[model samples]
Target: MRECLELAPDAIEVDQASVVQRLGSSRTNCENGLFQESFTAAQGFLAATARPRCVVQTVDLATFAGLYDGEGSNDRDTPLEVILERSEALALFVLTLGQTITDTIRRLFSEHDYLVAALLDGMASLVAESLVESLETRFGRHIAECDGKSTTPAVLAYSPGYCGWHVSGQRALFSVLKPNEIGVSLGAGCMMRPLKSVSGVLVAGEPEIHDFDPGYSCCSGCDTLECRARIARVTGPVCAKREVAWICSDG
Candidate 1:
């Protein structure tokens, strides 16, 4: 599983526009030369320092509840239950951009280069997204082959912190994923280390459940007011500063 889940750093593509928007400006308003320069530097750093890794395993949907160890109630609308209703199996996964990216951001914060650092923070998010995209593609192909289908099946990755699922559900996630196999570990607070890492389940049986189009913004489902995933609406210079602070504050 570990051998098949190693994600090469080059596999993830950093979205400069998304990172720039997170910095509080669009391409037109932001200085062309400065944005390009900073973006180039950040992209280079991400490509060079990011060590993308992942682990994936298939589990029977019937036993999905056992993975939680009787943690949550038998509520029909619970995230796991919702997933099980749509699929016969689940692909539990853990993915990360590795410690190098986190360490680089820490160093940048120490040096007071918050602008570039925050941009890197946003870029790291994209890198993780790209990793998941790649994983989903591969998962779809493999599942199709197993079922003797002409087209790949769909795969949707959902994390504990999103949807109605409380972030504490990560305890259950780690119980099944063993994230450390991919160089990821849960912090004392249940947040994954490396800051940019992500984990969750991928339901594989239904197209409507897992067939999300590429480029569907995760931001649409996220409402965290200060999330780095939130695109800046030209709020103000202070808003951008708050984003930087949020990233540095063990985000």
Candidate 2:
């Protein structure tokens, strides 16, 4: 949505369709019904705002994002193996996310349950934040493609709550990201719904200054091609919307 130069070289590969479908299905058939349509309106929001200032810029954050391991999802005092073995913790982990998202994709289509719809939409906005990171990777790739100079791929996604960043940092991140740059906006309830979802920045350069920790690399490592249209996306191809529009327009 941001009208700058072309994108940079993208790195991470994940099934965007699978993730969205999974999010939608998990929201619908799972314990709670969640509604996720941020991706659908991301472009529309950009179209509405039409300002290039909100687009996010690419930056190397190995130092900023992966600076400390003590701030990870793992407890500082606990060991990795112990944390993995704690079923209670794992259940809470899944359930917390589940509660955060009511029933995904259903309310977006039907709009019958207002409260559930709100919760689902809210969670979708949060998950949609990843799109911002993915775009950053592609933007990085675009920089390389257009510039014709080789560049390193993104090391990892650096969001708040990882390393020493408190989740509260979302405030600053939302503000600094400024959706208008890329055609997105944040809601009064801190929800970047519709299109202005928020994510953090991490550049690829000077590994000596910062590099992702091996222990938590899995979270950032993206070798899998999961997005439905990875190649086109990197080439600045936005995902097709016929099916998503059908879902939204259906009675």
* Top-lDDT structure, candidate number: 1
Reference-based lDDT, each prediction: 0.64, 0.34
Candidate 1 structure quality by residue, lDDT tens digits, 64-181: 5576433662223444454467774568888788899999989988999876787788898876765665666666666888878896554556667664456777888787667776
TM-score of 1: 0.77
Give the TM-score of each candidate. Answer: 0.77, 0.37
Question: lDDT tens string, model 2, 1-251?
Answer: 12222121121123335544545555344333222344334323222322112244432333223322323443343222222222111000000112112224354447555434443344345434444444445544555576576853332234444443444545555453443433344456444444323344433322222322234433344354232132233233343211100011111
lDDT of 1: 0.64
